[model samples]
Target: MSLLAARDLAVARGGLRAVEGVSFTLDAGQALILRGPNGIGKTTLLRTLAGLQAPVAGEVAGDDIAYAGHADGLKPALTVAENLHFWSAIFGGPPIDAALSAMNLTELARRPAHALSAGQKRRLGLARLIVTGRKVWLLDEPTVSLDAASVALFADMLRGHLGQGGAALIATHIELGLDAQVLDLTPYRATIRPPTSRPAGFNEAFA
Candidate 1:
């Protein structure tokens, strides 16, 4: 069964259309990797799929998805375990043990999020998906600060996620060894928008 899908989708960043004529269907246990150069709308498309932003055109249909963006979404003042616990409560998933173990974070579970390294923070962000119990994951730059060993660990966890009937759509520059179908957004790039169409707030003076 199709877990999530986009049909002729168009996405905008600010007033400019970044991606257009984009379409795909992802099923349970499947994965899709989005590849494109900088400023090509990979993040925009992922945000649209995650429902953080509305699509400029076309349709996206899905539910119960977890979105992990560039930011770790952790509170600097909160401990690693506390962060996971907070999100787990919000999503009503299992305990934090599995997530901590999966990310190899058991040793540092008590450390404050601000005290962790960049890679450790990223691991915690990814762990949130496991705690959420969401079947679909939308990740943007998931491997940003991961080292070779951590990347390998992340790949193993991702494979495990797919093995358990979950799906993922990730926008990343490096390969995570998930053998995902590549969806290059280069061909779908939209033309730059005119200045007049840019979104302006009510506080701004009208032309």
Candidate 2:
């Protein structure tokens, strides 16, 4: 069955339509990759999917989603263990230790989030999902600053999540190796100025 589905969705910001006539269905163990020019509304569509942005039209229906953005929202003062505990408690999920270990965070359990490098922090943020056990994951730029190894680890986690009947909606320029259908929103544009020629330049929509 589909875990998340958006029907005839339309979102407008400041009287400008960012996404119009958008729709799709993401089933358990399936993923949907959203690709488009920056102002075309990748993040905006994510917000709407997570119920953070109200759409001007259309319907988004599904269970609760695990939402992660650019920042990862890690607390600097909290240790890796504490951060997972706090997030798990607030979000309600399964055991966190296994998740942390899977992300290779076993040694840094007691380390403060601020002390970890950028990649480590992102891992910690992702570990929160292992604890919450949410079936629907909405990840934005999940591979932002990670090294090759960490990116591999993240991909492993995502694969595991999907194997266990979970679904994901990711907005990323980097490849996740998951067989995802890229929903590009550029075709709906009435007037996309200066037409970008670069490859993988989703932000050109805002130009």
Candidate 3:
């Protein structure tokens, strides 16, 4: 069975439809790479799928999804291990030891999140996905600030996830050397429309 499916989806940015007619399915042990130029609503589409925002039209059907965006979503005061433990508890996931080792964070397990370098912090953020124990992952630019070696490590971790029958949809510019299908958003670009009146206290700037 498919782990996630999106049909005739339309996602908006700044209160304007950015991409529409987007449809796809992700099956277990599969990975789908979203490809598009900057400002093409890739993040918006991912956010809609992740349930951070509502889609203008269409539907995203599935569950057990975990999303990781540009931010690491880590608590600056928490240690690497503590951060994973926190997420594990929230998601009812397995032990943090495996996630720590997978992201090569075992050595820095006790180090505070604020103490790690940019790459290390990114790795730790990615490590949180493993502890979520969710079947589907929606990642937006997950490789940001990661070094070549770290990127390769992430690819290995993604392979492991697929091996376990998990699925992923990633929006990334760099190549991750994975056997995954690529979906370009150019064909789905929505025609720009006139700005519409906003509701009270609505902020299009952040939308």
Candidate 4:
């Protein structure tokens, strides 16, 4: 059976459609990688599938999904172990020890989340998903700050998850050494409208 399925889905941001007529299905032990350049609605689609946003059109069918967005959702004051424990209580899945060991975070288990480097924090965030025991993972740029070694660790963890009948939908620009069906989102890019009334020099203001 399919773990997650989207049928002719349409997603929008700020009242403008960003992904239209998109459909796909993910089954157990399967991974789907969403590929596209910036501003192509990859994040928007992931958010919609994660149930963080309502689709402009169509339907998404799934349950027990863990969503890790661009931000590593961690408490600055909480220790790495504590953070995973918190999520475990809410989602009722694996043990904290298993999760920590899966991401190779046992050494930093007692350290405050704020003190960890970018890669450590990302690992902690990924560990939270493992603790939840959810069957599906919705990841957006999960490898953002991870180095080569950390990326390899993450790939191993993902493989273990799939081995246990879990599925994943990932949005990333770089390859993570996983066997996944590639979804080039370029063909689904929405025709975004230009800003209506910005100052002439506003484009370069943030540059």
Compare the candidates by TM-score and give the number of the best one: 3
Prediction 1 TM-score vs. true: 0.92
Candidate structures ordered by TM-score, highest first: 3, 1, 4, 2
Candidate 3 backbone overlaps, count: 0
lDDT of 1 by residue, 65-175 (tens): 999998888999999999999999999999999999999999999999999999999999999999999999999999998999999999999999999999999988897
lDDT digits (tens) for residues 58-99 of candidate 3:
899998999999998899899999999999999999999999
Candidate 4 structure quality by residue, lDDT tens digits, 1-207:
899999998888776777788999999999999998898889889999989888878899998899999887799999998898899999887789988988899999999999999999999999888988899999999998899998999999999999999999999988888989998888887765566654566443221
Using lDDT as the measure, which candidate wins?
3
Per-candidate local distance difference test: 0.91, 0.82, 0.93, 0.89
Return the clash pairs for model 3, or none.
Answer: none
Would you estimate the TM-scores of all the predictions? Answer: 0.92, 0.88, 0.93, 0.91
Candidate 4 whole-model C-alpha lDDT, 0 to 1: 0.89
Clash number for every model?
Answer: 0, 4, 0, 0
